[model samples]
Target: MESISITPTIINPKRVFKKTTGEEWYNYYAGFSDDFVSEILNSFELPKDSVILDPWNGGGTTTLNCALAGYNVIGIDLNPVMNIVAKSKFCNTDDVLMALDIVKYLRVNNYPNKLNDESDFLLNWFDYNTASYIRYISFSLQNKCNTILNSKVFSLIFLALFKLVRKYIGKFIPSNPTWVKKAKNSNDKISIESTKIKIDLKNILREKLSATFVDNVSSIGKERFYCASSTKLPLKEHSVDAVITSPPYCTRIDYGIATSPELAVLLGNHPAEIDNIRRTLTGRTTIDKSFLEIESLGLTAKKMLLEIFNHQSHASVSYYYKNFAQYFIDINESLKQIKKVLKRNGYFACVVQDSHYKEIYCDLALIFTEMAEENGLSLIHRQDFMSKFVMANINSKVKKYRDKITANETVLIFQAN
Candidate 1:
């Protein structure tokens, strides 16, 4: 139970979480780094059966790494798409291979030749031919639902199709599922040959199947994931040994839009449902202003929000202020839930980035530490380092104000008492 040393160096997942093939379950954006998780876990003295809980288990980074390290884990997230990811990553090698086999067969043998989808979301992003191809795969998968049910094959199929469509077809253009702005091919400026380069679905599937094979999949720990909100985790009090997670960024990166293509395939047949789902996620704005008690936000956070609100000359300032306020409130509620489930003296570590709200710095790590302490956990350690990803994200927002952005993160560890 010695504290781990921290260097000023930033933690990068690409460098830290290296494994054999088949580790890339989902091409998710902004997941916790496996190396960061492993570094923290190694510093803790724990039993082999210690239960690790990651309530915001995006892409299953924490669960997958810890399971490989032989700890049992319970990961929870409100997004069903991410739930599918964590669950699929932990599936046994046989089941994963089985899923790949079934999906491959269905995709190739029973391909539907026509598009039946009238969803504007799908239509706007995909050309007619691409749409038809995607629809055929969806139809074939739906027809084989019984065979794919309770297995990871459905998720694998969805993920492979997601990559094929997003990388090859969608061209990484839409900011969110809402696609409020009309969609245009960014590649139009390039050349017809580059944009129209043929993509072989069968070849892509074959490559995906090969990449999805896990050799030491049997060593993965006993794990479970829930598509439940973190504010109301479905676990008993004092049940978990440790909590390792990184909550969604305060930056306005829409999770709904980030995974819209996957959702379109998995949940949405209509384009309107995409916006409906976006509104339910924690980070989005709230139109109702009646419930905001800005005064209740801690002094540190309240100062940051007021600065953003006061500095803004636009009518939309209130909207941004309210969204920022709601984000902190939501985080506080989640902290209470984490405290409730963690055993006394158990550790809770979060990787959080400090972000800007209209050019005013929001010391998110300090705010989260204060909030966690208010909810019955005490801060044990704090480490800071610069992250290029954070700087790039902030710069995207800062370019509007013509301000320079510097980004750094803090690793806050707290003990439940």
Candidate 2:
């Protein structure tokens, strides 16, 4: 099949409602379309034994689609919450339903009063009693899982809990759609009794089970995912036939904070675990304040760095530059890792949107193109779709600086040389 231009909607996750099972389990903000991944499988000439990989497997879109099409696949993400979400894709509906019986043994009043600092993080969004109930259910599920099979069965249950937490906190969804914040007033926090929590979660599970095809139909083994950072992949050299994924956007979205509810559920009571993850994630707003000498950045990236550094806006040099620089460094290392694992002539397909450092255009595709080439991946195909102005919307003040440059949702295919 000859390659065709990708539709702009391929980058949008609006098709999530149109999905089932694991694809419908957790809808991440940065994930691409299921339809798009299906299209890629239909077009790409992947062999039956080909190992497809998504290093930044946000919401498992690429990996799930690849697995569904009967290919050996792996998905990796640093977020533990996503690890559960993605792994839950392999769960059987019968096993998931049977696992719900474990929850009956948990008594709301029996929860430990001695909460960890991280467990307390849930209190801001939920009341103490409700939070305790949540922790009780979470811990009960953890304790009951004795083997790998039970652990994965409980994962499907946790996916329901993850979704239920969001439904419980609908009032907390702030204007910035990316963030789910703690309500300012204590009265605004969610406080459902123990009975409702269990009932609501079970209802969600039952509804989803009836609708979703949870059983793994593929001949290949399940659990084809890992919880790890993108900069350091656990795979061997030249093991992968194709790499398809969208790394975190260069736009400083705090994915850690964006996914606090699910993170709280996965991390059990260790709330501060997110801090380690946030600092580790690419394009984090939190600057680690580390100085890195430029190595892998191409001329285009270096030039953009200089432009952002020279800008007179607040913290352009001290903060924004460092943030962008760190992103470049991390992405460059990830490209190197991608190159190392990809078989010779294996294709690395990426979907990245353009952004800005204040009024300065950060052409992510072009910047990534330079770094990919520097990392020994040669760009073979490029297509750009007109996109809504993201940075301008992110910072309304950018309008004063003649931010006439619009953003592009670009798809670039690079072959490992």
Q: Would you list the C-alpha lDDT of every candidate in the order shown?
A: 0.68, 0.76
After best superposition, candidate 1 residue 127: deviation in angstroms?
A: 3.3
Error of 1 at 254 (Å): 1.5
| Leading candidate by lDDT | 2
How would you encode candidate 1's per-residue C-alpha lDDT over 1-417 as one tens digit per residue? 333333323254332444556445556656667778888887676788899999988788888889889899998887776777666665554654565566545443344564545553555566655555566666567666753324466766665666666664344454433332324663332122212222344444456554553454555567777777888999999999899888987876677877776666565555566676677677765444458776655778888877867874574366777788888888888999999999888889888888776657778888897788888898877878777645244235467764556666677888888
TM-score of 1: 0.83
Reference-based TM-score of each model = 0.83, 0.90
* lDDT: worst 10-residue window of model 2: 1-10
Each candidate structure's count of clashing pairs: 1, 1
User: Candidate 1: misplaced stretches above 4 Å?
Assistant: 1-25, 91-93, 107-117, 139-143, 146-150, 170-205, 208-214, 285-290, 391-403
lDDT of 2 by residue, 14-127 (tens): 233664443456666666787777766655676778888999887787877787777888889888777777766665667666756665555656566534653476777887
